[model samples]
Target: MEILNEQVPAPADVGNALIGIRGGSELDLDLRLEAVHEGILVSGTATAQIAGECGRCLDSIEYDYEADIQELFYYEESEEFEDDDDVDQYWVIGDLIDIDPVLRSAVVTALPFQPVCREDCLGLCNECGINLNEDPEHHHEILDPRWAALAQLSDNVAEDAATNKTSDKREEK
Candidate 1:
């Protein structure tokens, strides 16, 4: 049994499109390695600095995320995982275990698919590309295309009514 605590640089492409850990950033790893009957068991946590854009408002978002890491590396001669072809199996290579893939899997899976800067973010206006969070009341007076014909009809009716009223007043005078 052994404890491994180290700070290493984060790898590239450690998350989804919306959010990810920047390459070369600080990564803190705190884990315990144990030798079991089948293989070596690694369980720990990896903390990384996350950076990305908000999916809602396209704003810059930055935060820290800690991902849990746990996996078993089987010895070269071990045949325990041979029956399960669907599951991925890790191996101990030359008395060393490569935890990069394990750490990456842990961090990437925990990242949000759609990252947002805030829960109440109003997002951007589709019509004008303006951030609604800055001005929540901001809007454009855009009438629906389906109702445009009805609006035009109402304007024409008002014009006709005014014209008739003016003619009637002239006749009375």
Candidate 2:
């Protein structure tokens, strides 16, 4: 916002654009003013650090984001003014154009739809509700229900054999 002042010397109205972005957890921008044929074209970069949940691991995600912005301030009577296009327009008063809206828009445009913390992150298990990151042992087990039924049948057979042995011993005594 400090850099948007007209008091800042502007480049000659030509093909030049000025650009700068201030760093913060949330960013502030210095309007990049490029001298254009019709008006001063402001273009530059700003950044906002996005910190929140990771989509995959559900861990805290921190991202450094950079965005580019462009804003044009045309004089009311400037030749670029069109009657129909002028119906909905933004204007600058006292030789000053505010670029805050432009800055906000640029940052939003550069953001990812869903930010991930890491590329190869192993997410939490849906069934056991365990954090895969924390556990390196027994990562996963695959079970077949048919095999499980066979295992149960073997256990019952062993139990029956042991019971029959005890009954025979009692009868002999």
Candidate 3:
């Protein structure tokens, strides 16, 4: 992860090439540097597995993901972008370029929103307050009136159907 030595005058010729970076699941980085006309082009892929709570069931979930990132560090400094508020961020110092920031950016951007253990995970039961995944046979007590608007609607529909049937028979005769 140290590139201070590689970043020197051309005569230094230390390590301006590919380097492997291994860190926490924060990310595993593989980086390559190319001295282009503009500046050093850092290209690499970051991969890692993360553990998080499921959005629906609150269960622990683990996911492995990878993000490919490329960053351009222009050597020229101008008034177009200011570095006071962190707007100007470049890896070009004198000759040494760092890819940590680029890999971190890619890993952060690749993270998922609202992690989920499984797409079909059945969340806790609203009535019994139980994890549905853990106990499939769990049931909650039906205390309140579970049948009101729906029951009335069904009864009214049945009566109307009976009346329509009777009318139909009379008309047929």
Best by TM-score: 1
lDDT of 1: 0.91
The best candidate by lDDT is 1
- Give the TM-score comparing model 1 with the true structure, all chains together: 0.92
Q: How big is the positional error of residue 164 in model 3, measured in Å on the Cα after superposition?
A: 36
Error of 2 at 31 (Å): 2.7
Clashes of each: 0, 4, 1
Q: What's the TM-score of each model vs. the native? A: 0.92, 0.55, 0.55
- Compose the digit string of candidate 3's lDDT tens values, residues 92-119: 8776666656655665555556555777
Q: How should the candidates be ordered by lDDT, best one leading? A: 1, 3, 2
Query: Cα lDDT of all candidates, in order?
Result: 0.91, 0.58, 0.59
lDDT of 1 by residue, 2-111 (tens): 99999998999888888999999999999999998778999989899999999989999999888888899998888776668878789998799999889888888788
